[model samples]
Target: MSEGNKNTNTEPWGGFDDNLIQRGGSAVIDMENMDDTSGSSFEDVGEMHQRMKDEEEVTAEAAATEEEGGEDGEFLGMKGIKGQLGRQVADEVWRAGKRQASKAFNLYANIDILRPYFDVEPIQVRNRLIESLIPVRMINFPQKVAGELYGPMMLVFTLVAILLHGMKTSGTVIREGTLMGTAIGTCFGYWLGVSSFIYFLAYLCNAQITMLQMLSLLGYGLFSHCVVLFVTYSVHFHSLFYLLWLVFGGLSTLRMVAVLISRTVGQTPRLILCGTLAALHMLFLLYLHFAYHKIVEGILDTLEGPNVPPIQRVARDLPNAITVLNATGKALAAGADAILTQ
Candidate 1:
């Protein structure tokens, strides 16, 4: 091999070594240049990391906001359901109350059929009461008027209540329920029996009257009895009580006669009917008076007994106490006069 050839081969290897050194040197110089810009590059990386964290926080807040909105919606939905239930209950209660009120009203008045009777004006009631008190037939009285049981029912109840109150005040030893029942039954029985009897008689005579009308007439006639009872119980005078009884009884008899005569055709029949009715009415009046007198006498006997009530005893002794005080005062005055004369 020539010397040049050997040199060439060696130079090829050396060039390869030089190429590696140049590559290493260039790598070192690039590293030095990278160090000069290291601070700026780090700052850029920190900015990117901060931006990523900010995005993550935003995402979490949005998710939390969505969850709160969903909870609020659920709460509103429950409130709406509760409000609907409350309204439904209120409607049911209002409807039930209306139904109960309707039933009670129907039971009492029967307003559909008895509207006219129930609709009586206040002035009409006053006039009717006044007319019932008078003995004569009223000129403007409604003839063949439809009968109403409400007025008679109220009057009977009122009379019974008054009697019960009076009995209680007199300290009667009767059971309240038994006395009330007996009184109501007796009153109704007597009224119905007498009215039925009169109705049968009128029907036989072919009178143009109804049982209801007859009952209404007789029922109104009981007003005198109520008045007599009140006056007799309130006034302590026996004579006044008897006088009023006679007057009211006579007036009631005359009124019945006047009304009954108009219903009959023949003179003799009318007179007979009136006489019978008057006799029956007078007997009833006598029975009432005797019963009332018996009650009063019984109460008086109770008051006069050894076990007199405290209220009665106080009333009875008040006048005696006053007389004693007056006597004491007079004796004191006489003593003072004697002292002055000395």
Candidate 2:
């Protein structure tokens, strides 16, 4: 029984050992087959590595492109920003220059021109004057009038007055003849003086003046009595001189009004011309008191003897002088209206 049991145990243990050897041999064969397989060779591993390297390089190139594109976009945005800023700066500069030019131009280059025509308070006067010269551009009337005519016309008028005085004072003519000649010469000198002033004013203002306008301006002296008498005494016109004065005044006023209207209507050139003429007219009126005194004194000294009756000569001369001066003032006033319109 013992031998039989030992044989059975030996048999069972030998079978178990054989099974273990077969399983181990199968695992070794499977491992060797997996190692030498054609489907997973070193060349396949190398191809996989090459693909990963290629993918890495593509990723780096894409990153670089993205970085370059970001830079390009930033550059474009900066350029656009700079261009917009430049335009804004240029516009501001241009506007500043225009404003400066405007501020430099003022009416008559004097504050006294409107004093005779307007009776507004001092504060109002300055305000009105500033209003009249609004937009104060260098091209406005005051600058043109002052620049072109002020000095030259003064010099010319002075020369003419001296000549006229000399012509009558040389004692070559009789007293009556000298008086008449001096009167006529004085009238001519004054007319020439006014004409030159107007012409210079027109030239600077770019006005299209006709010969008729010049004649009308010269003939305006005929109505001087009415203006002075009417304004000074606050009297109404009733006489023939007064009627004549009214007609001339109307004509001059209408002409100036038309100029102002044109300017307001966007006729810029016409407005500038009218403004310049008006400014010069204002300046001329300023000189009238002094110039008239000097010229009249010179004429009287030349015509009437030094011992002649002062009252009689003055009485005779003053009325005519008043007549001319009144007309001149009216004309200047008309010119001012035109400038205001511009």
Evaluated at residue 5, the lDDT of candidate 1 is 20
TM-score of each: 0.50, 0.23
lDDT of 1 by residue, 6-91 (tens): 23223322222222212332455345434544535556675445433443443344345445555442222332233234334544
Write one digit per residue (lDDT tens) for candidate 2, span 234-277.
32223643453445444443344343333232466556655555
TM-score of structure candidate 1: 0.50
For model 1, give the 10-residue run with minimal summed lDDT: 13-22
Clashing pairs in 2: 102-136, 102-137, 224-323, 224-324, 224-327, 225-323
Q: Which is the leading candidate under lDDT?
A: 1
